[model samples]
Target: MLVLMLSLVLSDSLVLADSLALADSLALADSLALADSLTLTDSLALVLCDSLMLWLVEELSLADVLSLSLALTLCDSLTLAELL
Candidate 1:
């Protein structure tokens, strides 16, 4: 009877050990997946920032050209008034 009790306890301990190992493996997998997702998110954010900078530069250049044209037009009108 004592032998049987000891065998039962040993078997239960083995099962518990197996379950703990499985839980650890699952936790590691979840951690790796989260790291990969964070990396992907960082890459996407960098791409969006680059696109925004390009658009801003284009808009600034366009505004500069329009202002230059307006200044030239004003100078021409002033010269015409002086001649008249």
Candidate 2:
């Protein structure tokens, strides 16, 4: 009877060890997944920022062109009036 009890205890200990190992493996997998998601997020953010910068540059260029056209029109009108 004592031998049987010892065997049962040993089996229980083995089961506990196996469960601990499984838990550790799951935790490691979770950490790796989180790291992968963070990297993807960073890459997407960089793309978004680059796109925004390009849009801003285009808008500024358009504004500069409009301002130059306005200035030229005003100058032409003034010259024409003086000639008259």
In lDDT terms, which candidate is top? 2
Which portions of model 1 miss their true places by more than 4 Å?
40-84
Error of 2 at 14 (Å): 0.4
- lDDT string for model 1 (1-84, tens) is 999999999999999999999999999998677557655645454454445446556666877656644543354333322422
Q: Let me know the TM-score candidate 2 reaches against the reference structure.
A: 0.45
Worst lDDT 10-window in candidate 1: 75-84
Clashing pairs in 2: none
Model 2 ranges off by over 4 Å: 39-84
Candidate 2: worst 10 consecutive residues by lDDT? 75-84
Candidate 1 similarity to native, TM-score: 0.44
Q: 1-84, model 2: which lDDT tens digit per residue?
A: 999999999999999999999999999998678558655645454454445446555666777656644554354333322422
